[model samples]
Target: MDRPTNPTLIILAFFAIYVIWGSTYLLNKIAVTELPAFMLAGLRFVVAGILILIIAKIMRLHILINWRQFFNTIIAGFLFLSFGNGVVVWALKFVDSGFAALEISAQPLLILLLMRVLQGKKIQLMSVVGVVLGFIGIYLLVSQKEIIRQEGSVLGMFLIFLAMLSWGYGSLFVSKADLPKNYLVNTGYQMLTGGGLMLLFSPIIGEKWTSPVSWSTEVQLSMLLLILFGSIVAFTAFNYLLQVVSPEKVATSTYVNPIIALILGWYFLDEQITLQSIIAAIVLLTGVYFINTRKKLVLFSRFSGKLSENK
Candidate 1:
């Protein structure tokens, strides 16, 4: 029989995913300004992965999986973290944190279209409307002359678009992929493999590595917050919520994350949130809401939920 869940824990879990995950954008923005993007992301995930495994070990949770599960975790890790997240971190060099978050808010729409193309799943009428609005919102957001004219801004936006594709495909893959039974172990493996890959690629792409001891106090604190709260605590809470609450309720992070990110970015980073951007955010998020209106479309898989968090 299933044990009863505490309401307080549920609320706390929701807070972690909602607030902590949203704030990761600002954290990454701060760190990337001073550190090499891949290096920063790689170190963050590798350290977070180690800590998660340690915690799991202390709890005596199963930490070993078959070779197949290990291999699949690597693939999922590459798609979701190495490309989906690492590339986005690189893009942050040119784009505002809030802008990136707003653009990424269209992830559900991408998943819907990917389902049509890859899986031959029919898009429902409401979802079709969502796809249209999502595109319009994207166009509005990207068409701003001042934003696009910035050096490397177009490239950043393009890379972010590619990251969305990777994340969308990763979501579909994880939904059907063979993974470890324990959610914590599954996440640790993905982070470990993904972060390892980034560390390997960082030097090859000519990104300089620096010791963390030399980082500015702000960057150091950002990395610590990212590893501890953004990756581990928020993700654990996400998995906990998945078990206790309805997936749709858990998926509400889709609507809240970008808003939180926008507000935090504006306040802390002094990133501009223009009126046009606001309109675009509304249109884009409304589309996400429609696409997710069907319970069947909710990204209920623990991995996909993590993807939705945009961490």
Candidate 2:
């Protein structure tokens, strides 16, 4: 018998993916202060993947995957981590982080379109409206000055768009592809493959690793936090959510993540939260609520029902 998804567990998973992943942006900023980009990400994935595999072994879970699944998982990993995240990291060298965020926030709409165009899936009207609202909300949240403050080439914007496309397509591929039954095993293999590829490419692009011995205490802690909480915990939840929820709903995390990051900055870094951010949070979360609950809301159906009763 298949196990049912617990609502509480689902909510907790969403929380992990949203809040933890959001905080990772800050963690990455801190880590990259001392560590090289690709090398840092590569080490994070390889270490986390190894640790997760060890835990799975201790639990006596099946770790075997067939050849097809292995290749597919590698492809998925490349698309999501190597291409998706690696490109974003590269683009940040030229593009403003805020502008890059705006581009990545397009994933939900991209996924929704891909689902319809590529897979012939029918989406609800409310879902479309929700996605639009979510996009607008994100625009509102990020400062207008940040969006127009271009210090880089158009190539940076193009790269971020490509990253979002890769990420969206990779997510859809995972949902349909043949992967290991156990989520833990699947996540571990994906990370190992993706991170290994990044490590392979790091030297070719001339990213040399300085010894960590002299690295600051904060940088060391940031890296550890990324490996443990960001990769292992948050990514596992993300993959699991991809399996259980609608891809668009999973993409809704893109909207919630910025909110969490903003709140984290306010509380920990003493950053100021503007009135616009507060309003954007309300609008963005409302859209996510609609995306998740459209079936129950049935606003159109209720309106039509009232019309029939009046007749």
- What digit string (tens of lDDT, one per residue) describes model 2 on residues 1-311? 65568788789889998888888766765676577778888888888888998989999998988999999989988998888887776775564443345456556667777888889988787777778777777677554454345466366777877888899899899988999888899889888998899999999999988777778999888889999999888877888888777877787786778666666655665555557756766776666555555464467889879999999
Model 2, runs deviating above 4 Å: 1-18, 91-106, 138-143, 153-159, 235-256, 266-281, 296-298, 303-311
How displaced is residue 124 in candidate 1, in Å?
0.8
Against the hidden true structure, what lDDT does model 1 obtain? 0.93
Clashes of each: 0, 0
lDDT of each: 0.93, 0.76
Model 2 RMSD in Å is: 4.4
What TM-score do all the candidates reach, one by one?
Answer: 0.93, 0.78
